[model samples]
Target: MKELSTLCYIEKDGKYLMLHRTVKGNDVNRDKWIGVGGHFEKNESPEECLLREVKEETGYTLTSWQYRGIVTFVYGEDTIEYMFLFTADGFEGTQISCDEGELEWVEKAAIYDLNLWEGDKIFLRLLEENHPFFSLKLVYDTDDVLQYAALDGKRLWL
Candidate 1:
């Protein structure tokens, strides 16, 4: 199966908004900390998907954001997800309860301490460093352990 999605890290005061995936029982990301965003609806552009997903999940309309990267996630042999990654610095709205999980503004450095997927650590670090727009591919086994990783067409680990 193949999927297209958007994910964004909204930043303010040296922190990023993060979601703790604790609400869904069958979620692939259960107990994991991740950014806000979701799959694209038919007829939606990446920007439209980003805006809609972020608004739905976080109750904030992004006023300023950057297309940071693209992450191709390969889960074993059957499932692949192409994710549009974004970073937003400006937004306005009152926060609300998210049905998907609890939302928290975590310190940038502290995010590394969260329960995140290994591949997420890689891309999160790239975002923190303000790296140039990139393409990252991450492959994982059934156990969810990262098996391979590449950055911008250069193999980094395996």
Candidate 2:
């Protein structure tokens, strides 16, 4: 199945809101740290999905956000997910508990210390470097090991 989704990194004081995926069973992202977002609802645009997902996951209304990139995830050949990536510098609302996992504001510099998808490290670095809107393709084996990577159509060293 080709799934469409959105993921956002909301920033405040050098920290980004992160979700530790520990709550769900049989979750591909179990025990991994990731940004907030989810699959698109019926006829929802990327922006629309982003806004709704952020509110649902963090209880925050985004005041300002930028589309960062598109990540094409090839999970074991058949499970492909095109994830719309975003970075938000402005938002307003109180945080809430997420049923998907525990939420925490993690320092950007310390993020690498956490357990993360290998492909995520690449895109996160791009986000940290303020790279322009680009496309990243990450192919992973059934075991979730990153097998290949590309940026803007060019293959990257794994």
RMSD of each: 0.7, 0.6
Output the worst ten-in-a-row residue range by lDDT, candidate 2: 74-83
lDDT of 1 by residue, 57-102 (tens): 9899999999999999999899999999999999999898999999
Q: Please list all clashing residue pairs in model 2, or write none if there are none.
A: none
What are the per-residue Cα lDDT tens digits for candidate 2 across 86-139? Answer: 999999999999999999999999999999999999999999998999999999
The TM-score, computed over Cα atoms with residue i paired to residue i, of candidate 2 is 0.99
What C-alpha lDDT does candidate 1 achieve relative to the native structure?
0.96
Q: Give residue 23's lDDT in candidate 1 (0 to 100).
A: 96
lDDT values, one for every candidate: 0.96, 0.96
Query: lDDT value for candidate 2?
Result: 0.96
